[model samples]
Target: MISTGEEVLHGDITDTNAAWLSRLFFEQGYALSRRTTVGDQLDGLAREIEHCSLTADIVVVNGGLGPTSDDLTAQAAAMAANTGLELSEHWVAEMEAKYARMGREMPETNLKQALLPQGAEILDNPVGTACGFVMRINRAIVLFTPGVPSEFKIMVQDQVLPYLKALFPSVVSQVCQRLYTFGLSESGISQTLSSLVVPEGVVIGYRSALPFIEVKVFAPQNCPNVSAFYRTIIEMLGDNVVGIGQPMLSEISGLLQENAMTVSVIEEFTGGALVNELHRDEACASLLKDGRFARDFAKTDKDLASLAEAHRRETNADVVLVVGGKRHEAVSVALAGKGAVWVQQVASKRQYSQSSYRTVIATLALDMLRRYLCGMPVFGHYESLSSLSSFSNERRTG
Candidate 1:
């Protein structure tokens, strides 16, 4: 793949198109062999296209297809293929019709978009003005696409992928399974699963994305022991496992709806991030009775428990969650329910940025509620955090 434009080459804009394409192709059993970035210079773009054509069976060229003066991909493609540019009268009419629908006249400069290399096949772009095209350069088939993410993605799905599948019929698809876990460091997760043996042609990998660690397994679709191997790893990890191919927030939301429970939240150290994360799920949002930012409350576990209970009574919710702490000190999470109150306090084992610290606290608070809902222990052990104190109380009735 050759990504073109000064913005992408100079890092002025993120190349999300490349990342999206890589994932898309991998999932379709066609992994990209190489990726290259070139500026808007015609000679450089032509050179890169010619270079990739010799090594790859297929090459995708992105960007430099707009109507502006900087758009030079069409010329570069023509140079690489040793052909002259020819105007596509059909695309010119399509552009004119599109502008007429919008109640405006098409600009003269837009005619440049209709210009294509000789003997190239036009790839229609339904969402934007920049049209895509396909041409052959030496041994490789080069496909050109616009830089707009929406248009590029749609064209790849509707046009490029089908063409590739027909071109390469014998490619075998691989199966991938993902497990999401929180409160465990990447090294700790690796050490815990180090003794397990994986079958041949199966690969296990770990990726740390902030407060959660993702474990991914890749194997052939016909692997017989993959399911059992996956279950064993989950059992070894125990309560740290939150979901499969889903985040904790989604898991918590499902539990809340299944149990028909409503909740109110009060936060301090994490600001309003706890509420924001909960509101992201529609089911959770509907069940959330109240969400507030509280700063004047006492930081003690007993006081936090009392505050949560009071809020629960005020909102008449099934549960109330409260978080409070001083910066760079121990943080506390309290859960108040109908007949019991639970609180846990922990301190960070290493220094973290303010945003990261807040994110950890917020995730910890959510995990506590999730555990209680699942009928498990509310306090969890984390490698980067140490428990300071815990409290639990069951109310009595006469």
Candidate 2:
């Protein structure tokens, strides 16, 4: 959950926080289902809390926990639950003493932060002043958090998430692995996954665009053969599984860096997404060839190939990725003596999807990009060969 306090509302903050939190939940194996944002209104905040408390096993509410008048999340949660709130005598004394130690009288309104519902627990904060709260309602656990990211992250990691997981101890350890593939459709992934009854707890999801399939397993934690089973799956899937654990754009770029190699970017339609992925890591920065934004290509009457060639020579970069309009393949024009041939097929049919189109596409591109860089003749597309060797004579052409 994210919120916009009446005074502190900002657009970009919510977008970044949501992505970060979702990644954290994925890492922690939480089945997060809903995300919501509401302007700072105590009534609105209360209603949302009520709704979330009804269905979710654990609801994480972010924002509006400051000492200001407009920061009303704590009070709103009490109202939403039809509970009363009064200052916690112990906390008020604790806070006032802390303020006095700093040689300042504690603002009276700071007492509002100590107010809590009858059954709620106060989450400790080591960094900031705002302390989050937690309580159970309608058989669901609700964890309220400060909107300020640094405070919220600390409280959640140090306290809230651990507490929430304790309530629902996973009977089956949820094990998941992402397998990326290029030159394959969602249907193709389905066909491949359907025949494998390898384990009862394993379920497969086909993500198109980032072009990979994910294998999720809810195997028993005590299962004796889990290691062998994990190895078997990895081996059976072969080189299609690019990198493991966390999805990494840096992994491919890091491998290139270790080999003292470089890569470049040419933007056509993907805006700066591809470029950001390429230049995200310092290791990837080694692969930085000169880049051309879409504006550079369309606004100026520059010779595209010659311009690319000059950048290749100037930066000594090998791989050049060209992003064009959708459904068109992204071609890599490897410099005569530079990087491997990396490619992509991006489509613009996601305007009507019920799933994550960006994840599908981005994951797929990185998977193929990694494999090609690793010297695998990817089976789904062409004959297997050393990626570096195949590009030995590949001139500054796609």
- Give the range where candidate 2 is weakest over 10 consecutive residues by summed lDDT: 382-391
Give the Cα lDDT of each candidate: 0.89, 0.60
Candidate 2 lDDT at 207 equals: 51
Q: For each candidate in turn, give its C-alpha RMSD to the true structure in angstroms.
A: 2.5, 7.2
What is the overall TM-score of model 1 with all chains considered together? 0.95
lDDT of 1 at 370: 91
Pairs with steric clashes in candidate 2: 209-360, 209-361, 210-360, 210-361, 210-363, 210-364, 263-287, 318-339, 377-384
Per-candidate TM equals 0.95, 0.63
Error of 2 at 72 (Å): 4.3
Global Cα lDDT for candidate 1: 0.89
Best-matching candidate per TM-score = 1
For candidate 1, give the lDDT of residue 103. 100
